[model samples]
Target: MRIKKYSFLLLALLAISFKSFSQDTTQYIVANRKNSLAQQNKPYVILISADGFRYDFAKRYNAQNLLRLGSEGISTPYMMPSYPSVTFPNHYAIVSGLYPSHSGLVNNTYYDRARKDKYLMSNKAKVADSSWYGGAPLWVRAEQQNMLSASFYWVASEAAIQGVRPTYYYIYNEKIDMHNRIAAVVNWLKLPPSQRPHLITFYLPQVDHAAHLNGPESPEAEKEVHFVDSAVNELQKVVKTTRLKNVNFVFVSDHGMTKVDNKNPIGIPAAIDTSKFVISGDGILVELYAKNKGDIQATYNELKKEAKDYDVYLKSNVPARLHYGTADDWHNHIGDILLIPRAPKVFNLWNNKKINPGWHGYDPTVVPDMRASFTAWGPAFKKHLVVTPFENVSVFNLISEILGLKHTDKIDGTNQLANKVLIKKASKKK
Candidate 1:
């Protein structure tokens, strides 16, 4: 009996030792796997912006390429644009991590009396000024982190903002060949993984061009959206079938278009003192350069009282709900006051019988008119997941999450979608 008891005690001690050793080994393995995953999950992020694409239009017009991309990954069903709901303001909002007002891109064209200059983001000269741009784009941020970055045709790309330039970019070519654009991107991806870009932006203007030329509902517009879809599909094929390695893709648009039934004039040429406000190109938006500080409110109130055909508000009086940055540097580029008309109504300054088809720049609060198209796919995204009613600011947060980087600037968005979709559940909880 003594011998049997001793034997049992020895076996128990050995089993206990083995159990502790096994626990230690399991913990180490788990930790190492997590570390490995962290290293492996760094993704090459691609941002695709198909200008003027509406939310419902994607499904209504049967965008098979977009639908297929969604089927292969995750998408936010209907993403709304920033206030004013114009392409320039909203697209600037996405990459800069700021709203239109905060980013100093309140409208496509706005007046600034301080420098006695008119700021148009499309103007290469205006964009060249770093102070004019509100914040750093992801490309500049990536460069700061010593990661490779490039842009195919994003706004402010040609500008030297934040003292950083993309590794590769086009010079705002309106007549750029789509195939050549795709080939340039593919060539960049073909570089060695170490030298390859971590972030890239692809802008497809054909759809937006077609939409503006042939109305968003026209068969020509449908064909344009499909053309973009085909391009996106081609990109998918290149990324999937190649040795490009780990990657992530985000597809988005600046704003949706609305059909106009009336020639609604937001402001009359006779209403504003023409000497004070030169009707800028494309009368859809106007810039008022105050001759002096005293002239600011006068110009503002005059337009407000007389331009009843539009909704006029001062840049200083911009709605707090929009979350514009309060810094002094950002305010100068904004007009003393902005004018935007209600839907089915467009600003009358730019009415050229030659250039009418479809348009944007309506108030963002109007839901049906404000909705834009967006989708995210690839290894970093969850397959076939649906996210609804997220804000445009959420995009910045999502991109930061994919690269395993953190941005402390308080934005209107978060990385909740990534956690909801991409993060894998632990088999057993800690």
Candidate 2:
């Protein structure tokens, strides 16, 4: 009887110890997961692009939210866009940290020699095709480092570049109401810590579209400006309700708009033979690809005759300031000769002409209308800071720094150049 009792006691003790050990192990795992979640929830960086919002538009219309952001954080008088100051090229430059030359998106619509394909922004398939895009966008860099990212209509965000995309992305839909877009972004911010995205990008096109239809200074454009401002106000309210910590906000524009009078259209010089080249781009910037490589010199000579009206140059002779021409093994998609019409002088390629009221794609240096808006407000930036005018390419580096992500070395932006706007520079040391 004594032996049996001793055996029973030993069995009971072993069972109790085993149960305690199992409970401890489970608690340890749960604790580790919680810590992991906290780590992943680091600070949030939200990049917003208000297409065609000129630098002066905010001050002109007394945009309350934009003015508040400018006073509270960092604001630049204007952000210079890359050459061919248009939509796709500049937007991609802002995200990829590369010039249009390096990103391979020289124009909104261009012909790719390798695939024998033409890429058009209107063509959804081509827009989503990874091959048409080059360089690492901000979202791609975030995902490669095991960080979460999301986008709501950001340029190039819809494409699965390098076979990877943001954790959450929606297809480009123009009909989606602006309020819905803002609500969706706010919802992403409200996700549980573990599911939250560290980086998010949202695009608002109403301002740009309005500016396109009506001149930038028109009342129609002002209404659209107020519309975007209201959306920003809603975003600010939603963000406060979440009580989220360490969030940064960046607002930018691809390029501004310039008035183009349809009644005063300038026709292409008859000296230039249309049959000798394949032309791409339709507005202020015209790209002419010679049918034969040998004809490049002859094409340049012919176009040079009318040099007073347009700045004409061969690909090799393109101004160094433009920073165009392909990098790496990518084909040179820019035309053999580029014809940039002087501002207020619009290009009318068609023999039959009609009026196009507004346009961009002008030389950013000379034309103030081509300068875009840039404002950043957050814990990462210095309060009431007014920075000198800088190019949009530096924006990519600024965003990467804010998100604490590693950027590809092939980028043209320098961290030092973009760091001028930040409050805590040493925070990015790691």
Candidate 3:
């Protein structure tokens, strides 16, 4: 009889211990979440994308603050980019939940010389025309569902290229107005809870700018990261004080940078007759629009076969695996062919500068070329968890889950994976 009683006591103690552990884990997750004034709070989602941010740079620089979020929440081992892995292409992927090809943006710029129009990324005359865009971005989707959304500096945020505009948006300008852009976001959050957007996006371009000029590991790049980090920390403080505890912030980047090797020049003489084609932009990649398609094939062919130092392919033949498909919308409409130079080297045709320090747009498949990092922390996530390799599109699916919105089309990513980032699993299933 005594043995039976002791066994029961032991079992009860074990149950208590397990319950304690479970509670501890749950508390840990909540501790990281911003506190709220009310018992029930609306969920919030914030996405911050840093241009030209590479994955390993986080480790190399000992980004403890960033790693803390990952350790406390879920993080992707390596997130692949959409084909062409450039800023515009991959940024479109993050919000649309589609790869670059499907999103209709293939490169930074596209040339429709035949129509006498060039698709450059400026706010001047851009519109949310249906022809140039594909699928809906997170803001558009949220707006369709009658939810509020906002964007700071995403590529399409300025143009409203798809009939979907954020509740608030800013014109894209890196130097003229970046802080004001961030201020607008904070101001929106200060509005009444009902008026505040459930979804918000913010972009920082300084890092990419420094990287392009000084190389990825240069002192300028370090300063850019730290400056951005300070800004992010400030934003976090604001969320905690405001009634914005419901917000779930996600920090991510478009792609990483590779050092330029100026040793060998892939000599494809300028194909433009100057009278027929116009060239724009400077650096590793040059944007050109030709009045004649005939020259495009010859120029493209030579770049592919003879241009050993560069990986050249026409818009149609861009590798499918990159999720960058043939031209279907405005994003992919311009470039007839893309020239991606390998690492330790970047292309230079436009002013033909002797050497360029840094570059992106390489095939993401090059393991060393993959850039960017992702972190999330909030009630909507699964805490202290590690997710397997994921793609930028997954972020869209995850946001949908947090907001309880439905996206009808099939996307490359899923909320199921993102859920692993901020929430804690119960010790025992109910």
Worst 10 residues of 3 by lDDT: 22-31
Tell me the spans in candidate 2 whose CA falls farther than 4 Å from its real position. Answer: 1-39, 325-330, 350-353, 425-430
Candidates, ranked, lDDT: 2, 1, 3
How many residue pairs clash (N, CA or C atoms closer than 3 angstroms) in each of the candidate models, in the order given? 3, 0, 24
lDDT of 3 by residue, 1-430 (tens): 0122332232222110001111111100101122223312447788898777787666666666677767776677667776666777688889888776566565555444445554444323432344556777888777666667777657676555555577666545444344555667678788675566778888877777777778788988888777767677777766777755466778888887777665564543444344544543323444445567677887776555666655666767766665543544335344565665656555445223355566676667774555567777766676787777677888887777676667777677766665565453311111
lDDT of each: 0.63, 0.74, 0.62
What lDDT does model 3 reach? 0.62
For candidate 2, the per-residue lDDT at 211 reads 76
TM-score of each: 0.81, 0.87, 0.78
Best by TM-score: 2
User: Lowest-lDDT window of 10 residues in candidate 1?
Assistant: 24-33
* TM-score of decoy 2: 0.87
Winner on lDDT (1 vs 3): 1
| Candidate 2 residue lDDT tens string, 92-207 | 99999988888888877776665656676656677778888889898888777777788876777768899877878877666567777777778878877776777888888777
Q: Clashing residue pairs, candidate 1?
A: 102-325, 283-349, 283-350
Candidate 3, residue 427: the lDDT equals 12
